[model samples]
Target: MSTGIPNVSPNLNLETKDLKTAPGVSLNENQSTVLRSILDLFAGKPSLPKLALWRDDATFTDPITVAQGRDRYAAQWYGLQQAFSEIERLHHEVTDAGNPILMDLKTRYVIKGINKEQTINSVVAVHLDSEGKVQKVEDKWDGKLPEGSIQNVSSLLDFARPMWWINYYIAWAFWIWSFAWETKKKMTADITAQAFRHLNAVTVPKLVSVPKNEEEDAKKGN
Candidate 1:
């Protein structure tokens, strides 16, 4: 899924046949298929095939926006295509985490109009529902200009140079924000689980029936 950030690299279209699965990762048949489809989608394949893997109420989240619904997720691609001149995947590492598959990617690309090139290291976590359709996706990344690139600060005069400082600040802010949000989200989930555990641990007293004529029964027995 696209991050909805302007001037960012267009998403790649990776082929299943081209990917080499990481060592010691075991994936079920369904998960393997989904993983392949996800790679293809990122490589810039037609949206229809990618969308088919997602549920109608699927959500895509990144630093910029939390897009809910398949339609919104699909729209981000259009913006990305218009913003970047070309996108290339440099390296990738895939991890199979059962229901939620994780992919770490390094990518490089050139922005349109300005011809500025950038590299990004990003991780995408995709969650699949019980039916094997994508339910949610979380994307996180850090971007930088490659060393010795024309866009490097030393290449341009101070006044004409790109305001890289601003970009640095923004990236840092996003990192902190994402960290805090994830922390809070995990904490909340933990608290909820603890609450349920406490509730389940509570002991209930069993009821005992009282005999109305205990004395009479004892006398009759005697």
Candidate 2:
């Protein structure tokens, strides 16, 4: 019988990582095998044989990317190796014990060619089809909604870096990100408010009228 999913490329990395669970957590026999296999992909060690574990149309989505099919999901994971030099699994824990397993992972990342590091927490929700094949994997970074339309492969690297409001970057990243965003937002709002105020300023005539010599003045100003 053919699995709907394509056979994983033999060239794909089958390396595995040690699954480090959070304190006070004990996994059942099934959860141990399943979670270990899945978490290894994010630990900078992807498993090629595990591709058969997912269904053909299985989706993997985080905040910035939406991918359909097991192949695309594999792309997101495999891209991790290219995007990052090091991924150290700090700890991970299963938050939900239901059909769609919710596992929260905290890991430290070092971008390739840069020694600067960032610690990120991602919550991976694994949904299983009726036959126990993977149906969908929703990565909610700190429990945020899977909301975004960027389908670029490059944006897949964002998964390895800092993103969204689960804040606390390597100090500088957080400071700059916060300051820049607030400044830009305030500046835009100020500009808009000033524009409206200028339009209704009392220094002008109370009545709104069609421009008379504006065209001639515009040409002269230019």
lDDT of 2 by residue, 1-222 (tens): 223334433333334334455656565544455566677777755554555567779877654345566545665565556446788988787867577888888888766554556676788888877666678887776676423232243333345434532443332242223223332334244443333222212111212121233353234221
Residue pairs of candidate 2 with colliding backbone atoms: none
- Give the C-alpha miss distance for residue 116 in model 1, angstroms: 2.1
lDDT of 1 by residue, 1-222 (tens): 331222322232325554455788776655665666666555544344445667779976554344566555654433344345777778777766565788777777566665666666777788988677789877665421111211222233245335634444443333233333432334244444333222211100001111124353234221
Alpha-carbon TM-score of each model against the true structure: 0.54, 0.55
Candidate with maximal TM-score: 2
RMSD of 2: 19.6
- Evaluate all candidate structures by whole-model CA lDDT and list the values in order: 0.50, 0.53
Error of 2 at 101 (Å): 0.8
